[model samples]
Target: MRELLANRVKTLTPSATLAITAKAKELKANGIDVIGLGAGEPDFNTPKNILDAAAESMYQGHTKYTPAGGLPALKKAIIDKLARDNHLAYKPNEILVGIGAKHVLYTLFQVILNEGDEVIIPIPYWVSYPEQVKLAGGVPVYVESTSEQNFKITADQLRNAVTPKTKAVIINSPSNPSGMVYTREELIAIAEVAVEKDLLIVSDEIYEKLLYNGLEHFSVASISEEVKARTILINGVAKSHSMTGWRIGYAAGNAEIIESMTDLASHSTSNPTTTSQYATIEAYNGSQDSVEEMRAAFESRLETIYPKLNAIPGFKVIKPHGAFYLLPDVSEAAQKTGYTSVDEFVTALLTEANVAVVPGSGFGLPSTIRLSYATSLENLEEAVRRMDNFVRSKWQD
Candidate 1:
C-alpha cells in the first residue's frame, strides 16, 4: 500500500466543537438526557420570509446555476447590505460569494497566502481559522489575549506578532467562544497596526447582527481607506438570519483577490446553491424582524444563564456583550473537582453529567470551556444546574 494522506490533512485536528456536539447527539439517540452547549449556530429555524423566498424561487424555476461568484441580484443585495449596515462601499467586481463564510474564508486564504507565509491569529480564536490558514499553506502565528483584556488582542500585541513572513491578521469581533465584541476604538487600534505592518486584514463580522446590550457592531474595514484597502471582510446570512444551511456567504476586498477567489470557487463549489442564494436574497432584502427576534432570544438566554454558570463552584466567567457563547475559566473548578484538566472535566460532563461543551483547549486556551446559549432557556437553565450539581458532587473542598 502507498501512503495517500496529504501533509495538509495529516496535521489538521478535527473541529472540537463538532466532535463534542456529535457525542451529545449519539448519547441522546441512546435515550440519554444530553444538554449540548457545543453548537455554534443559532437554534431558531431559518426565518419565514426567507423560507418562502426559497420555495417561491423553486416554483419560479430559479434552480439553475448562478454565476460562480454569485447571482448578480444576490451580490447587489449583499452590496446594499454592506453599505446600509457598515457604511462600506464595494463594487460587484470586489465581491466573491462562496458556499458559506467558512468556505469564503477558505477561498480567501487560498488566494492570499503563499507557502511559508505567516498569518497572525488572536488567541481563543474560532477553531477553523488556524486550520484553514494551514490548509492553504500559511503559517498561523498566535497573539494571546487574557481574560482581563476581554480576550481581545491589543495593537501592541498585534505589532509584536508581525514578522517579515506575516501576510495577514484576522479579527473576529463578537468572537466565537469568547463572545467578545470589539468596540470601534479597539478595531481602529488593530486596523492601525495592520496598516503599519502592511498586512491583509481579514475581518469576520458574521455575528454583527447578534450584538446585545445596545452594542452596535463596527466594521474594521470602515476604519479608514488605508484599513479598507487591506481588508477582506467575511460574512453571511448564516448567523444573522438563522440560515446556516443556506450555504451563502460573501467576501469583499481587493478586486484582484476577489477575482482569484471567484476563479478558485468556480472550479470548486461551481456556484452556491441557486435556491439558497434566493433565500439569502430575502435574508438581506426582506423583513429583519426575525433577525432581531432571534437576537433578543439569545440575549435573554445569556442573561439568564451567565449568573448560574458563574455560580458553579470555582468557575470564573466574564459576562459577554454579544454573540451567544459563554467562555468561563474553569481551571480552578477542574482542580477543585479532582479532574486533571479541563479536557477531562469536559468528558466527565458528557459521560457522567449528560452535558456536552467544547473545552478551551480546542480554542488554544486550556483553562476554560465554552457553553453556547443557542438552545431554549429551559435547556440552558437545566444544563447550568447539571453543571452546578456535577461540580458540587465532585468538589474536593
Candidate 2:
C-alpha cells in the first residue's frame, strides 16, 4: 500500500494544528474537561445579516453554479473592497474566487510553480504555505526569523535567499502563529526586493482587518505599480467576517495568473459554494458593525490575556499587534517542567492540565507554543489559570 501511494502524497504531513484540535475534541468526547486553545477560528457565530443574505439568496433560488472565477457582482464587491480598504484597484478578470483562501492559494501555487522552483517562506509561517508549494511540485525555501525580530524576515534576508530557481516569496502580514505584522516601510523594502529580483509576491492578507494597537494594515500591492503587478493578494471573509465555514475566498493579481488559477478551479472545485459567494457579497457590502464587534472582542482578549500569559513562570510573550494568537516562548517552561521538547511539553499540558495548545514545531519554531485567544474571555482566563498552575506544579520544589 505504501509503495502504491504517489511520492507527492506520501511526502505530505498532516496539519499539526488540526491534529491537535482533533485530539482535544477526542479528549472532550471521553468527558474530559479540555480547554482548547489550539484552533484559530473565531468563536463568534456568523453575523445575522450575512446569514439573512444567504437565506435570501437561497429563497430567491440562487442555489445554482456560479462562474468558475466567481460571480461578477462578488468580484465587483471585492474590487471595491480593495480600492476602498487597501487602496488598490483591479478589474474583474484579475480576481479569482474559490473554496476558501486555502483552496485559492493551492490553485494559485499550482498555476504559478513548476518542478524545482523555490518559494521563499519566512519562518513561523502558516502551516499550509510550504505544504501547498510541495503539493505543486515546488521547493519551499525558508528564511528563518527569530523572536528578537518579531518573527519577521527582513528585505536583506529576502534578497539573499533569491536564486535562479526562485520564483516567488510569501508575505503573511498579521501573521499566523506569531501574530506579528510588517509595517508599510518594511513592506516597501521587501516589495523593492521583489521588484528588483523579479520574484512574485504572494501576500496573504486574510487577517488584514483584525489589526489593533493603532496599527494599520498595508497591502504589499498598494506600495507601488511595479510591485502591484508582481503581487498576488490572497484574502477572504474567513477571518474578517467570521465566515470560515462559508468557504469563500478570492485572489486578486496578475490577470494571466488569475485566469490560469480560475481555469484550474474550473476543473477542480467548479466554483465556490453558490450560497457562500452570495453571503460573502453581503459580508463585504453589508453593515461592517459585526466585523468591528468581533475585532473589539479579540483586541480586548489580547489586552487582558497577554499579561496573564506572560506572568506564567518561564513563559515569555510579546503583545501581538494583530491577529488572535499569542505565540509564547515556552522553552524555559519546558525545561523547568523536565520536558526535552516543546511537543512533549504541549502533550503533557493537554493530558495533565487539559489545556490544549499548538506546539511551535509545526510553525517552524520549536521553543515556542501558540495559543489562540479567539474563544471567549472567560475561556481564555480559565485556560491561562490552568496553564499557570500546571507550570507551577512541575517546578514546585
Candidate 3:
C-alpha cells in the first residue's frame, strides 16, 4: 500500500477517554454489568426553555444557514453574556461561533498556526488539545503541572516554556481531567506573562458555569484590555445548558483572529446549525435557573463521592473545586494491586471490576486516573465501591 493517510492525520492519537467509554458501552451491550465513569458530558437533558426556543426558531423559519460568523443576534447575546458574566466587552466582529468549543478550537489553531510553530499546552490537558495542535501543523510544547500543584501550571513554568516558535498557550480552567479552577490571582499572573511574551492566550471556558463550592469562574481576558487583546476565549452551552449535541461554541478576542476563523468556518462548517444558534441565544438570554440547578447537582455529587474515592486503598486525590470529574493518583494502588501501569489498571477495572475510567496518561499524567461524576449519584458511588473492591482483591499488601 502506497502511503495513504496524510502525515498530519497519521501523527494523531485517538481520544483515550472516548475509546474506553466505547469499550464500556460495548460490554454493557453484551449484558456485562459495566458502569462507565469515563463519559465527558452531563447526564442531564438540555433545559426545556432552550429546547422550546429551538422549536420556535424553526417555526419562525430559522432553519436555513446563518452568517458564517454567526448571526448578529447571537453575537449580541454572546457579547451580553461576556459583559454580564465575565465583565468583558466584545463586539460582534471579535466573536466567532462554530460547531462546539472543540471545533471552534480546531478552527482557531488552523488559522493561527504555521508549520512548526509551537503551542504551550499544560499537562493534564483535554485529550484533544495536543492532537489538534499537531493537525494544524504546530508542535505541542508541554509544561508539566503535577498533582502537588493542583494540576495547574505556574507563570514561571509557562515563561520557561516559551520560545520564539511559541505562538500561544492554552488555559482550561475547571480543567477537564483534573476539574481544577485557577484563582483570580493566578490568572492575573499568567496574563502578565502572556502579555509580556506576546503569546496568544487560548482560554477554554466551556466549564465556566459548572463551577462548585463557592468558586467563581474568572476569564483571564478580564485581567486587562492588553490581556484581552491577545486572548481568544472559547465557551459553549454544552457544559452549561447540557447542550452537548447542539454544537454551538464561540470564540471572543482579536478581530483579525475571529475574522480568519469565521472565514474558515464559512468554507468548512458553513455555519453552526441554525436551530442550535437560535437555541443558544435562548440559553444566554433566557432564564438561568436550570444552569444553577445543574451546577448544584454536580457539586452535591462531588461532595458525596470525593471522600469515598479518596478512601479507596492506595488512591490519593485532591478535592476539586469545579467540574464534574475526579483525577485520583492511583500509582500506589496500581502497584499494590500488582499491575505494572495505570493504563493496565484501567483495563482491569473495565473487564474485571466492570467499572471504567480514563487513564491519566492521555492527560500527560501517567500515574493517575480520571473518573467523571456526571453519572447518577447511585452509579457514582457503586463504581467507586467496585474499584475499591477490585484493588483489594489483587492487593499485594
Q: Over 4 Å off in model 3, which ranges?
A: none
Cα lDDT of model 3 by residue, 191-282, tens digit = 99998899999999999998887888899999888899999999999999999999999999999999999999989989899999999999
Cα shift from native, residue 80, model 3 (Å): 0.6
User: What is the per-residue lDDT of model 2 for residues 14-58, given as tens digits with 9 covering 90 to 100?
Assistant: 898999999999999999999999998899999999999999999
TM-score of 3: 0.99
The residue pairs in collision within model 2 are: none
At residue 124, what lDDT does model 2 achieve?
Answer: 90
lDDT of 1 at 241: 93
TM-score of each: 0.99, 0.99, 0.99
Give Cα distance to truth, residue 120, candidate 1, Å: 0.4
lDDT of 1 at 194: 90
For 1-397, candidate 1 gives per-residue lDDT tens digits of 9889877899999999999999999999999999999999999899889899999999999999889999999999999999999999999999988899999999999989999999999998999999999999999999999999999999999999899999999999889989998989888888888988899999999998999999998999998888899999999988999988887899999999999999999999899999999999998999999989999999988888888889999999999988899999999999999999999999999999999999999999999999989999999989999999999999997
